[model samples]
Target chain A: MRLLSHNLLQCNVKNCKSNNFPLKIQVDKSNIINCEFRKEPLVKLIPKLDWNALAITVHNLAKNKEFPEKFSPALLDDQKFMQELHRILMETHIIEGALICEGCNKRYPIKNGIPNMILNDEEV
Target chain B: MATRPENICPPEIYYNQDEAVKYTNSTRIIEIQEQLTERCIELLNIPEGEDQLILDIGCGSGLSGAQLSEHNHHWVGIDISRDMLNVAVERESEGDLYEIDMGQGFNFRHGVFDSAISVSALQWLCVASKKSYNPVARLKKFFQSLYNSLRAGGKAVLQFYPDGAQQLEMITTAAMKCGFGGGVVVDYPNSAKAKKLYLVIQAGGDTREQNIV
Candidate 1:
């Protein structure tokens, strides 16, 4: 799943929907797959992304936390920063991992590049 | 022919491995899905410009999501079947896929989607899949959450195969309760085989989204 989508996803557990901001990543089982990148889509994507969620995911996913803590409209013009932003947003993939919710500690497994967000009966 | 039966197994089991392959690989389903997806998008009347995000409900094998990508729009597909999603993955679908049930509702932040579409999936929620399932309650939850997920004035165009008029009424009533405007739009009404029912819903906030049906 793209961290782009992960940046918007929240833990849908019964009461955890509000604060499930950045679902914690268990990166030991993760893998990165190379993908094609175009600068325009990434440029258009900046405003839609949750800066804090993406930054936190990078830190926990073992990617050395390359993101800046704050979001600036000017970052769109920064060629050097945009290239690194492209690397994290476009190139990396979470092939295998479990995303644990900060609010409910619920774990959603990611297998074969797809994140399984289905919840059981009691959990909902 | 794939109507929702009261005692039918859940989507995961019904669309399991071999069935998923059968559904995705069928030439007829692919043709039908393509036509239905395009029809739904045409009804969306998307304001053109940059790449917008669309949500595909029950996006089996990414056929519908591919249509969204053709317009350079991004999409996120949610389905209840893993095997179906596996095929979507193999297709190198531009959109991401998630295994989530529509009955319980989605997990998107407020005002995230530009618009939404569901093809041939809404009928599944009309029947009780489990003993604990309540049709009215499930429909309410789905509508309420879907109402919140869209940007104000965002539209969700859902194409469903209703068993009867009663089923359509139930779904529409629930949506109305959650503050949705717009109503059912029937395409090709004279031809039984080609007839399709679409619910064109707009999230109510400030502006009322008028239905073009």
Candidate 2:
């Protein structure tokens, strides 16, 4: 899964509140799938993003890479910034691993590049 | 298409798209639904002689149903929004359309439908803020109702946004708990638009598996 997606996910398991969102990704394995960048859609999405949270999550996931500390008007207009954003958001894929929710402490297993979220009746 | 009225509803309001571009190029929504439907048909392998009764949950503007109608099958559509249902009703053929909130319950009898489909609607059921209601619980209730409504071999096609790995797992876990056995199909991984995933659940009964192409 991309950090773009990680930013929006929050644990919904029965009032498991407080920092449930932005589930932490423990990457056991990952794969980078090359994807073409689309500028128009990226431009449309910039306004809706949580820039700081995204940067932090990307930093956590990538370790070595550093994203802009802030989203400036100039940065928003810059094509280079968008291209980098696009690469991080669309190109990164977690081929295998688990996304553990901070709130409910549920581990969503990723197999064959797809995350399986199935749970037993007792857990539900 | 005319300019959207000035008194546009808030983002929290379901099916309220102020931007005409969202509606016109809703190709993302349309394409995902088509892919899911095609997959469902392949998986079910419904015989030509048996009557095919299909139910579309949150059948907005009836676009999904319109596509299903091409197969000359019996269908029914239900939606919570009156405006959306009205649009759907106008486009409907022999099928019945009802203004029913799926979060509450489908209000159908057990094994009544041959198949069911919901697309781009579950996320709207979620109450994003304090003033809004949490429809996720209601959604679970709805899925239970759907499980009851389908025949032993019946299938339900649901297309929703995983948001992230956690959300994806949450939804799949919920579906399995609801008794659906199938995997998900990720549509358009690269598009910055709302990335959609199709979850096809087949009710366990007949050994014959339907092929989802």
Candidate 3:
């Protein structure tokens, strides 16, 4: 799973509504695949993102990296910054990890880069 | 007539390791899947020069994900079968894979996807895989979550094989109840073997938009 997907997913465990988003990334193994950066796609996707969530994940998993706590429209115009954002969001893959939901503390395991989001029948 | 695999077991069990490999290795199945995927993309009618973030529901073995990649679009795929997702991982599919049951509802943030597509998958939701499963409730959850996941004008093209008129009605009605607009498109309606059913849905878009049947 990539950070791009992680930014979108929230815990769907039944009746656990608050703080379900931005699952904490517990990375045991990670991989970086070099992909060509496209500014247009990222430009369009920027508005849809939860900036705080993205920043938090980057800070937690990607140590020493600091992105602005707030999203600035000006940042979209910077080619180098957009490239960096693309690499962090799209290229970095979580090979083995577990996403811990803040609300219910449900651990969704990631194996071989695929996240298992299946919930138990009782939970659903 | 051969019995439906859905009647035998749920997707996760039915598409076991052996079945997953056999399904991917079949030339006929691959060809059909590719053609249907291409058709779904065409029906999506995404504006030219835009790279979309697509969601592929029930993306078995990355067959449709490969097609999405060929179009240079980024995609996230969700499927119920672990064995099928393993095949997708082995294939090194460009799209991210998630082991999720569609009937359980999507977990994505609101308006995260530009468009969505499914091929040969929706019918599985209409069948009760377990004693406690309620098809109506499940279908409502699936459609409601799907409606929430797409952009306001985003579209989804789902190609499925309905068991009969009743199954088709159940699926369409659920989508409509969730505020989706548009309707079914039947291709090659005159031919029994070539007939294909596509549920072309748009999220809160212009209700007057007509589908090419």
Number of the predicted model whose TM-score against the real structure is largest: 3
List A-chain TM-scores for all predictions. 0.87, 0.83, 0.95
Output the lDDT of residue B201, model 2: 83
Q: For residue B180, what is the lDDT in candidate 2?
A: 76
lDDT of 2 by residue, A8-121 (tens): 344434445576656677788876666557666466556545677677678888774657768887876788878878878766766568767776788867543434443433
Better-scoring candidate (DockQ), 1 or 2: 1
On a 0 to 100 scale, what is the lDDT of residue B185 in model 2? 72
List model 3 lDDT by residue over B107-210, tens digit each.
Answer: 79998899999999999999999887899999999999899999887899999999989999999999999999989999999998899999999998642244
Q: Is the docking of candidate 2 incorrect, acceptable, medium or high quality?
A: incorrect
Clash pairs for candidate 3: none
lDDT of 1 by residue, B41-158 (tens): 9899876665777889888779899999888888989988899899888888878788888898888888788789999999988888788989898899889878888888889999
Error of 1 at A52 (Å): 1.5
Clashing pairs in 1: none
In model 2, what lDDT does residue A65 have?
A: 65
Model 2 chain B poorest 10 in a row by lDDT? B3-12
Order by TM-score, highest first = 3, 1, 2
Candidate 1 — number of clashing residue pairs? Answer: 0
Chain B superposition TM-score per model: 0.92, 0.75, 0.95
